[model samples]
Target chain A: MNMLRRHWPWLLVLVILLAFPFLFYDWTKGRHSGFVLTLMSEIGVMAIFALSYNMLMGQAGLLSFGHAVLFGLGAYCAAHVVNMVKAGTIWLPTELIPLAGGLGGLFFGYVFGWLVTKQRATAFAMITMGLGELVSAAALMFMAFFGGEGGITIDRVMDTSLVGVRYTSPWQVYCLVLAWAFIAAALMRLQTQTALGKMANATRDNFERAQFVGYDPRMVRLMQFTLSGFFAGIGGGLYVLIYEIVTFDTVSAAKSANALLAVYIGGAGGFFGPILGTIVVVLLQSGVSLLSNAWLLYVGVLFIVMVMYAPGGLIGLIFMHLPIWRAGRMRELLLPYARAFPPALLVLLGFVFMVELASFTTIGAAQGKRFTIGGQLIDTTAPMPWVIAIAALVLGALWLRHEARGFRQRWDELMEGSKRAQATAAPKPQEAVA
Target chain B: MEVFVVSLLNGLVYGMLLFMLASGLTLILSMMGVLNFAHASAYMLGAYFAYTISQYIGFWPALIIAPVLCGLIGAGIEMWGLRRVHQNGHIAELLFTFGLALLIEKGVQMTWGLLPVPYRVPELLDFPLFKIYGTQFPAYRAFMLLISALMFGAIWLGLTRTRIGLVIQAALTHPDMASALGHNVPRIFTLVFAAGTALAGLAGVIGGNYQVTEPAMAFTMGPIVFVVVVFGGLGSLSGCFIASILMGLIQTFAVVFDVSLADLLAKFGFVVTSSTPFAEILTVTLPRIGALLPFLMMVLILVFRPRGLMGTRDT
Candidate 1:
């Protein structure tokens, strides 16, 4: 009962994930939506990748710009292993392909970790970036491992699944991805509670202090980096199975940036932050990208705003209200939040409207796409829409600012009340000592 | 001999262009402790702005106006965006600039579409300036060299000969001390950042027509400029100049020299086959590996000399 209570959220999430594909199922055709499955699988792979990235950025205070090297190498290894299995050179279970990737990632991670972990701070970042560029260039040049520009492709149907699963369908591959994502995330979560994890945090907070306490900060960073690489490689292995191809793009700086975006936007403070971030990022990449060409612009603006206003990310913002919720004063600020919502939405719509207008005039016009609203064709070369967009932006911004002041006041009052209530409710340290 | 002379001249021109971009980035990185990931975006903005302005006015007027416009935008970004994020920490500042880079790239695409602009050299500078063997060097390249040299001389004079330069130098070395000595450090930072971006804008104006003015230009040039700064050692202008010239020369000459490591190895009686490890690396021509050289140099430098060539402080 205790275990059930503690693990209810995970179980509930599993149930939802299992049921999600049925919503898009073509019952008459007896087929699932390929797009949804691919997107979800992408989310799973990217979540593991982002979690590994947080091991460095959040836990160990190491900012790497070349993490994709590990992931890409792992993928290449997995692809080779799949090819080997097909040639009857090795007899490995299909389920264990990701393990081969993990070993590859671990090997390269150790070698690269030794090179980069010598220095901490900015120098480490620069070295990793240089290494990333080198590897990416090599990926294009060398045909043996990276397979040149065409990359390495594999047929995932090796007919060697441990449980007799043929893995012919995207559905099967997605299930495998989900399983691996769960296992990797669980292992990583457990890793955060270990001595190395504690020492990594300690080193991140105060390297000098950690060193004074007889811990080698460099060793801690190297170990964390190597372990993170192991998980990232698993993600890469799953990527190969889903797409059946790994390209230089996997090892590119852009891929590394994707991991960074996931971790930063998710909330690096908590374990589940990267997972949440992966969902948002993948949704934006796959979903919003289909609707608007300015999706990247929106994501960029959101990232900047979050960095400035909410460094702790989406999860951090939720955690901020914990004190108020615990004190039972959360309802007091609800009205203020409601009041602020309209203008905020107005500002968002207005900004998006202007962006869409501009984009339509240039990129859309080139592609022969006309600006439209509710099936009504809007002229891109006209002045009226521009005027409307500008007016809405200005007015909505002003209104939002006005509401923001009220929201701030209420928020402060509730937070102060929460603090006072918590102080009174909890036993005092000084009294306990006496 | 002809190839050597021409490659050297071209390398010199390319090197000067790199210096123009690297100088600003070095100033921002050293003084502010912010890497300014958007530095190359500023260069890209310069190209786009010059292209648009040159469409109405001539290239000469756009050359002057575009950099000033970039300087103004830099000032606005510093005053509003960076200053707000300054309190959060250096990482926040870096992320802000990174986001700004993405925004600027998207904005450029939305406004200009996803095509290279036809920003060209003026008719007056279109003819050949010199002929080496059977090849003609365009007068525009000469003009670029002249402009860069003049700008370089002006920067040297401004930094060494002016009171404001002295103040900036002091602030760069010791911000808190400069503040204690009655200088507004933040204002100086804003000034330096704007000036640095303006320099990058100047490089973009000249290099855009020489190269191609495209959205991806920022991503392509940004890393190479970073390599220059890192290799030269952070905060050292002289080292940056040397690194830039060395990189430019190496790139030019590598293209000229079609030699391979395999050939050298064979001469030493150690012939390599197709199945050898890194066989592609051994047989690859110098020109094919030219793109990897800067990054290779940077990594080597960082590993062997963490402080860079002339770096006084640790990066």
Candidate 2:
């Protein structure tokens, strides 16, 4: 009963994942679901990548900018193995290629982590950046392993299977991604409960204190980084399996930045934060980019807002609501929250309108494209549109501030009340897991 | 000999330009413990601002106005944006600047369009200053030298002579002590950040035309400046200067030379072909691989001398 209670969420998640393709089958029929399948596989890949990154940034507190190097290296190694399979040289099943990638990741991680783990904080960040740049540059320069600018491309159809499953369809590739991602995520989660993981956290909290406890802080850091690399490598193997092509972009700073964005915005403090963040970022990348070119700007703005206002990220914000729920006062603040929501949204829309106007006037006009929303064409040269944009921006900002002030007051009151209630009643469980 | 001298001179000029950017960055990094990823954004802003101001009031006046304008923007960012996010710690500050960089990049692109602005050297200084053997060095290069040197002097004098400079020096070296002495450390941070950005702006005004005034100039110059700062060691101006010059010279002189490791190995009668380990990497010439040198140097330094060259404090 205890095991079932504890593990039910995992089972539920597994069921949902298994049902995902079937659920989208009616909507994404024929040639289109290839897109959906690819997108889903990408999510799985990014989730594993981001979760691994969160191990460093969130749990271990080691910020690495060159993490994608491990991922890319893994993919490249797997690509070689794939080619070897095609040539009938190595007799390993297709399912075992990712293990080869994991071994490659571990080897590189052990070598690189030795040098990097000697430093901490800002110095670590710089070293990782330098490392990232070196690898990325090398990936472009060397054609033997990296395959130069065209990157290493290979056929995945080797007719080799471990469990009688053909690896031809995108759906089959996605299932592989899903299985590996789940296994990798579960392993990483299990890592958090280990003594090494505890030591890593200890090192992050206070290096001196961890040392006082007779642990070499450097070794702890090295272990965490190397282990994180192992997971990231598995993610990369999945990447090669899904796309069948891995380029220098996989090892670029931008790719590393994607992990940083996902981890931070998802709430680096939570185990599942990066997982959630990965999904949202991929969704935004696919959905928002199709609609507008300013998707990056929006993501940047959102990231900054999250960093400034909610240091805990989306998960952190959700966690903050726990006290109110436990205190049974969730409904009391709903009305105030609703009142604050529209003005906040209006403020966002106003800024978007202004940004779109500026972007349209400069870039859109140059490209000879008209800015249209809901079939209404926006004339950038017109004074009325400009005035409307400005008014919406400035006025909405002012109104948001007013509503925000009221919201803050109510929020503080409710939070304070919850705290008092908790004090007066039985003491609530302390949040120690993170 | 002429190649050596010319390359050396070119290196010095390039180094000085890098110093203009790195100097401000080193200060912010040392004092705030924030890498200021947006530091390069300030340089780009300076160029764009100079380009706009130059269109209105010509190049000479634009140089002064653009830097001052950048300083104001830096001040605003520090006071409003960074200050608010300070409680969340250094990572938040870094992310804040990263976000600011994105916003400013988009803002610049929106305002100035995607293409490079036609920001040219003034007609007054457009002539060649010196003829090295057969090569003509532009008078604008000399002007860049003069401006950068003056900046170095001004910065030196200001820090040594002025009251605010002493406070900054104390904060740079002993931040906790400075803060405990009731010296309003936050205000000092604001001042340092603004001054650093102003220096970046100045670099942009002079160096922009030398390079090119474009939106992408930030990313190009950004990492190179960071390399200079790191190579020179953290929190040391003298070190920053030496490293900048060294990097500048290396990059320029590297372009002059066309030799590769493979060639050197073959000189010793070892004919390593494409099948040899790291053959592609070894066969790549110095000029082609010059861009990799700084990163290689950075890794080497961090590994052997983590404190950097001539650094007093460990980073």
Top candidate on DockQ is: 1
TM-score of every model versus the real structure: 0.98, 0.97
Give the 10-residue window scoring lowest on summed lDDT in candidate 2 chain A. Answer: A23-32
- Provide the overall lDDT of each model, using Cα atoms, as 2-decimal numbers: 0.91, 0.88
Docking class of 1: high
What value does the lDDT take at residue A223 in candidate 1? 98
Q: Note the residue pairs that clash in candidate 1.
A: none
lDDT of 2 at B2: 91
Q: Identify the runs in model 1 with alpha carbons over 4 angstroms from their true place.
A: A428-434
Candidate 2 residue pairs that clash: none
Q: lDDT tens string, model 1, A216-312?
A: 9999999999999899899889999999999999999999988888888998899999999989999999899999999999889989999989989
Candidate 2 runs further than 4 Å off? A26-32, A427-434
